[model samples]
Target: MSNLFEGSTFCIHTFGCQMNKHDSERVAGMLEGLGALPVDTIEEADIVAFMTCCVREAADTRLYGQVASMKNISVREGSPFNKRLIAVGGCIGQRDGAKLTDELPHLDVVFGTHNLGSLPALLTAAAQEGGHRVEVLDAADDFSSSLPTDRENAWAAWLPITVGCNNFCTYCIVPYVRGREKSRTLEDIAQEAQGYVDAGVKEITLLGQNVNSYGRDLYGEPRFAEVLDAVDATGIERLRFATSHPKDLTDEVIARFGTLRSLMPALHLPVQSGSNRILKAMNRRYTREHYLDLVKKLRAVVPDIALSTDIIVGFPGETEEDFLETYRLVEEVGYNQVFTFIYSKREGTPAASMEDDTPREVIQERFDRLVDLVQRKAFEANQDEQGSVVPVLVEGTSKRDTSILAGRSPKNQTVHAPLPAGVEIDELIGTTVSVKVDEARTWYLSGTVVNEDA
Candidate 1:
């Protein structure tokens, strides 16, 4: 291990959700400040960091496989120059830091969710002394920023308004891992949005474990709408947010999306199961009818708002009827995207203790059926967008072909078109370009950019 500053290139492989993506940005900023440039390939890096997650057991397994490959490549080749210094951090690091180090001796540093601020210091020590270090600290501690964040893009940024969760859902590990909810000050958040605006950010998603419950623990009341209005005043071109809980969503929040031009017409609400019994078993608090009613009300406020949802196919005691109810609900809503999953019992969660009589083969069968239904619904939904023009934000050249540039709409639909010279991300990144939906895929659309309308 060598000082992070000693090398000029580093690569980061981030897993999990937008929160983890934000964490990666923070790490990138710190690395850049330490004089390490970002490298897309691991072979050319001085440090290679893996930001991991354990929300799903599959994610945990994925990390181990990656670690094994890295160890094999570096140990067998005996080339530190090309191998790069390996580091593991984030949620998986918090859960399995010591165990990972004991199992894989090649890792140079291990940091956790609570120790993001200490990443630079850990890298410094690892480089100078050469060995392994773990800095998880405590799970309950709040992370107040004393770190840099080299945001991967300028137009879009994830500003963490709050972190952690208080709701102890029977099927979720977030409460156990992320600790208690801690809302950052309103001034801090508003100021952060202003900073992003100053940095040419056209859009900002105020992120949190439970966004609608923001400021309740600190400001003594729900101030999400107030904060939204405050951020809107900053003149950011677009606004978006995610993962809203059904119980916490309010009319005021829904109404703002309609009135506030920048608030994009899209929201992802997780209705884990359509059956009330399963919802109760999962400690979700809201019923299926209640969620549907909420969706109806949201549509009333924002007529064209795209609805997306999450569905868990087989909870412990799910029956065929229960699965059918979910499928029917999926059809009824006509979700833009359905994040479907078969339940995986998390360790230390109440669901793990409950009798999961539903066999894996049965769950797998149901999951496959659910996915098939989602695809049919998705195709139907995308077909409606045919001949309709969509406003999209040009991201960059498509990964598959550099001859074409790609971007997303305010609603986050991916669009690809030819890359014209002299066009920069800032000039065309956030600006709306009319994309004719001549061709549509299950999730994205391929269309030529309309120059006059843009």
Candidate 2:
């Protein structure tokens, strides 16, 4: 096929989870493959695409506001194209479809989570035909991993072992927008991981809505442990997965924490709420006690594992007692990090129509208390890392201080260190180096370089 987008400059704005980020990378790769150059900002590009999220009402508002603002941006005087093309894809496009162009009349192309590969064609049609071209597929025709990728970091990659979700949590729109669970074949995933490793990638984070349920749809049973084993054999240095549902977290997968050599010692198991009544209402399929037991089992195997979680402050019919339960659970978990959110009613979710009598002030107050507790717990967790030497996979120079290098430890803690004497920041961007802890803050650690050769 001819490169239809030859010489055009494009930029993509992405929102939401790692899955969406990976999707954007694939979109960038596709555009680049069609002979388009990537620009850092929308104003500089002939095409501006948005990979959107509709998980929270806030995300919808943000997407609408940003897309609306682009109506004022005009094509550069000497640009390669006659006009700027605006495209929207991912969750919001999947949900709203043709309605999006109606809402944002300037939108030219509307793709979706399932039809990301259709973006170039749609954009071409819109450009030549001069009308809105929207194609929102109801199901995925292929695994997106098979598509080319333009990873932001050459040393790191997001590999999706599964796409979509089956668990219809009352408060979540993910299952509805993303469709049912569809696991990629284990062989395909292993081969992809091997490819990343062969290409000098240092880290691979397995992506899925609920990673614990991986391979269930394809193999008729959850084989996530085997997936880990397969990826671990690929010789990747750092491995991780996200958004594990507590109910589906099996003993076999938990054992991998102690056994897998390449698996990082960090987990993002989201316990959305700690009240059993609220959990039941959310259709999470696990009680607070069951979640606590799972945590206990995880700690027993990997005692020093860094734990992070997501929590919702308020839901329908939540009372002070329910809120207390959540507060107490946070205290007990003592997580290294907590992503707390005040409940935002997504329109299609069941919770949206439920009785939410909790006042906005009450929810905000609860959120504030949770944030304070989370910060304290995080500070305490970092304090434990003080005086220890850790190997950090360097990301880049710290944004707050240029002379300092910033990276993540195996537990995913942000560890910063001064540049080695005579060493340039670029030299250490993707290399692993040892840092001896000198200070521990609430969210990150600072240290001196202990092993420059690592």
Candidate 3:
């Protein structure tokens, strides 16, 4: 890569999951490697890139609005970033491809999910050719972990063990956009974790669409448990993984929670709907009974595990009974957090073509009720932490009040403590400090520092 764009700066507006966030970090690292500086806002930068997500219609709508605003700014007479290059990357770019350039005439470049390594060359071409340049690979040429990353948080980093999805859920477009599953070599992952620990990374989260299915492609069997063991051996302070599929969450994997010292007592397993009828229609491959069984195994191993999940309120043909089934499951499980959504039909997904007679008002009502139950459960979970001194890995100063420093407890709950009189703010970050939980709200916990050497 040549430094032809040296002295330039960039700002990346990212949307969607942790994977997308990690991709944006790698993009920033590549730009900086090409001698570009990082900027706070799009208007202040020479190039503004969007790491987009197309999982829902809302994401698409947001992208269109943001790009339109940037396009107008580029043409504005007195704008500082009037000549800025507008680039689109990630899932939306992978899906939309040349269509994005056609839609947004101001769009300078488009690169796909698997085409991140090609970004430097794509940017160079866009700058030199002065035309809309697009490069989206049919399949992943290289794993993103192989690329450099400019991590936003110094305390932690995201290590993806697997890329793409094998289970083609009827409602998800991931398989079409991200292609088949590809597992990273175990040695490469472990080495990376060691490097992060050496760089003072207090925690690391292994990322994947279905982390439980990791290593099946390579070894002909799921080796996520082994992957966890290898990474934890690197001496990392804390470990976490996300977005597990209930169908593939093996007993061996569930057993890791209680045994692995570094593995935090938290899991985010998405069960789109609790109704077996809805799950079968969605091609989720797991029934309501199976999900509860997995939950049972998890609790049996790690009783205090903070469980979170994703629930879609209204599918195409969902009935009141189906919705009530979900309500009952939420009550039974008492999830520490619940991400509820009204299902949006994507054009290519099977669920899109399914017959739907469910009314919009009914869906909205169900969504509100679900939210009420989830909030209550969340508050109860937080209340359980009262009077407990939890080990919180300090992240930084809280957003609402800078005087209070914020960090995540072992359960991944946000814990904030007032900045102590004697300690410097910088010293608190990346260090696991013990805070006696004095107050607990539905969303966060407030406490005072009891011990700094945690």
Candidate 4:
């Protein structure tokens, strides 16, 4: 009970992207190394650390509010919850280390991107001497160290093949905050994938800021295909990666996907905009035709591949015609889903310094129109699956009703079906089950489980 790690339990509250989520895994791995058991609820935790993010202003505000609320929870208890050592970390800590520590003195330990390996030692120090904030943002460490993690689930897991980003996209903050692209060695990544395969991980989403740009620092060129081949060699049932740069998605990589059966029928290729002017403004190296070409390549290999994209509607000087150009591309491609947003300017990005021509109301209107187009396309796309039987890896029970079960198809469509009679949750997981599409919503699909084993 003296050291926080030696205490009863610990919980990690993570924010931001997949990279941050992977960082939380390393944080958990560190705590477990120091003899800490993961707690499901903060109420039961003797130590709680917030793996924070500061990309969105809202992420920072939400983290502070969560920590402050936890403090109130501790105070309201029969005994002071000061015994529960609270901590804050990630980009927020990297960006505002001393200021954050001075502001929230209740936090036990605060660490930045570079201090993951030193976390256990820091936690030990914080427990004895009280609250401490240890941030080393500018100092990006090179050594790749391993840590302990209490995985969130079994069948599905996020396997980080790389860390950080180098691309200084005009409107992005990741490169500055997370530092240059640092890839974990191929052997390390493959070993991690093997571990998941051994543990019965059926579906693995290989994560990174720009997945296609993986291994450029190590193998000389972007070796994402090599990484994929290595992971696939481990005999993992399913494989996927995301947030690809159109420029880095070479012919070899797209061709590899065609041959790799495990690589599913879904790809999250984020084409920020369809206008050549807007694309150049955002510092995306690929042109509008290039993105369409990449989609065509992916479609040629996997015809049923579901397409999803990220589009910022009113990026700085976006004109109405530019917005219409984006809409026209959406209509032409008919993506299964489109993530549309009115761009939020980060203070340091190149685009932020540019003159803002698009009005706020206009941005909102354009965003709404983009969303409307996506909804109509999604409905039309699902209409084709009306009577088809599809195979899905049953994830678990449905959220709406436990009487039903949930899973995902090769295209990564969320499907729910009645709980198969006499089927246990353990048996249902990690196994391919056939389901008939009974109905389709804007997002998820309703299905009925078939076969006794399914």
Q: What is the total number of backbone clashes in candidate 3?
A: 0
TM-score of each: 0.93, 0.98, 0.97, 0.93
TM-score quality measure for candidate 3:
0.97
Identify the superior model by TM-score, candidate 3 or candidate 4: 3
Please report how far candidate 2 places residue 261 from its true position, in Å: 0.6
Residue range 1-454, candidate 1, lDDT tens digits: 2343744678899999888999999899888887777878666566889998878889888888887777555321433343357888888888777888898888878988878878888877776677887878665354434468888777789988888888788988876667777888888888988888998898898888789888898989878888789889899888887657888988899889878877888898989888888899999999989998988998888766777888887788899998888888898888888898878778988998888677789899999999999988887777767777788877777888977768886667677776556665456665667777788778887877776534
Screening candidate 1 with a backbone cut-off below 3 angstroms (N, C-alpha, C), the clashing residue pairs are 2-127, 3-127, 29-150, 395-407
RMSD of 2: 1.2
lDDT of 2 by residue, 1-454 (tens): 2355788899999999999999999999999998889999988898899999998888899999999998899896666556789999999999999999999998899998998888878888887778899999889978888788899999999999889999999999999889999989999999999999999999999999999999888878999999999999999999999879999999999999999999998999899999999999999999999999999999999998999999998898988899999999999989999999888888878989998778899989988998999999999989989999999999999998999999999999999999989999889888999999999999999999985556
Residue 231 of model 4: what lDDT? 89
Clashing pairs in 2: none
Query: What are the clash counts of all predictions, listed in order?
Result: 4, 0, 0, 2
Spell out the clash pairs found in candidate 4. 29-147, 29-148
lDDT of 3 by residue, 355-398 (tens): 99888999999999999999999999899999999998988898
Q: How high is the lDDT of residue 321 in model 4? A: 90
lDDT of 1: 0.80
Could you give candidate 4's per-residue lDDT for residues 334-375 as a string of tens digits? 888888767877777797898986678888988888898999
On lDDT, the stronger of 1 and 3 is 3
The regions of model 1 sitting more than 4 angstroms off are 1-4, 75-84, 139-146, 419-427, 452-454
